[model samples]
Target: MAPDPPDDPYVLHARLLAADEAAFREVYEAYVPLVLGVATRVIRDRTAAEDVAQEVLSHLWERPLSYDPARGPLRAWLLVLAHHRAVDWVRREEKRRGLAAPHEAPRGDETADAATDGLVALRVRAVAAGLPDTLREPLLLAYYGGRTYRQVAAELGIPEGTAKTRLRTALRVMAAALAAEGITP
Candidate 1:
């Protein structure tokens, strides 16, 4: 018996790139659930997740040519991009809420807490700086940005599997690095 033919992502991409609405719709319908799943992981809000998914689709429509088969599969690429964008959105939202940064220091308590926060920030920055862009970006998007694995995949423009693998690898390496610095999660 013959094996089923592999789905030609490049052909599909070309059709979508040509602005074939039906082709675009097909891709959207096929992938929205996956995208939403990833977005929700990051934003932790249904509405925002949906919005991010839509944005991801819009980006695909606008720049279909950006999907390069030579680098990796199309699904991975889309998911990575989604993940990155969703995490960015979440981070921005957190900043807007003032949950991430202190607004003003209380006389005595503020000064004490500020120093600790600064120290942690410095350590985190140092660790992050030490990471290559591949690992650092994904880790930041997932942990700091609050995006799901799928969302991270979309943001990075890689496959869901690749995203999962990268996250796992990044976490292990970061854990080891942090442990050496006496930072325990």
Candidate 2:
């Protein structure tokens, strides 16, 4: 393939903004490798990294306005986007693994502890199920979903402060309920 023109990124960006298909193709072919490399380095999983790279490229195509020429070159912007997406992927995987961790049987002779933990988890889930939806949503996202309060807020379309408040309220209600039921830790 011919090398990308040595034209200024601003010009290419303008072309992209104008919805020139050829310009977008050129940018995609030119920068995909670099973006993939950044994602692979951060994600450390080739398949997951490639997924992030594809998502970053798709986002660039769908939201060309997200890129600003004054910030830096297009290449740098693409690399940062790829890196952030890869990091987010890693965070989500970590959360999934963490949520499953408590359910896994212990590796050694801690069968008793594992059993106890399972019972506690069951009770917690039962308590959570009785919570109002507004309070339950944030609590599940933070505790079971392994997301931060900010993430819970973003996912639930609420302010971060509101997410925090709701999670706290849910926990307090659960605690009181558990105490009333004589379900002590």
Candidate 3:
């Protein structure tokens, strides 16, 4: 997980708007992983995700006023930006590859993505792969392994509340990832 932001967003936002290098660095250190993680969950390419993270952070540095403090917190705003950028990156890649739509099947000439099959399947794998082990293990066990949450708690030796929270966090992560991809899940 990314470290919490070093200071209140408004303070940071003000410093950023003034082009403070220290403020930018602090924001980068605190949130780059989170931004990259979101991008990676959608993109599934380390290089591409790193590019997305850089673009997002650079946008923050170059146009800090674009982030409005009135509407929401800076962190949520950054996540939204990251999501949009990742989706845009995927769309651009698909277009460049001659695929008409994101969900459309890749052409026969295109590489098979190592037998991953459909775009949806690849995206599912990406999202699953991006989840933390604490979240992913229980998610797979409960959903794929057909275990109850109580059983998940017992198996992981965690309290039931922790199990439930993990499940909830996992679902939220999936939902956010899918939503970023413009999928209704």
lDDT by residue (tens digit), candidate 1, 28-109:
7778886777677666788998999999889889887665554444555556566666656866776778765544321222
Top-TM-score structure, candidate number: 3
Q: Estimated TM-score per prediction? A: 0.51, 0.50, 0.54
lDDT of 2: 0.72
How does each model score on lDDT? 0.68, 0.72, 0.75
Choose 1 or 3, whichever is better by TM-score. 3
lDDT of 3 by residue, 126-169 (tens): 67767999999999999888999999999999999999999999
lDDT for each residue of candidate 2 in 1-185, tens digit (9 for 90 to 100): 22444668789878888988888888888888877776776667789888998998888788888776654456655665665566567667766778435434322114323433454565577779879999999998899899999999999999999999999999899898655433454
Worst 10 residues of 1 by lDDT: 104-113
Q: Kindly report which residue stretches of model 2 are placed more than 4 angstroms away from their true locations once superposed.
A: 1-5, 99-185
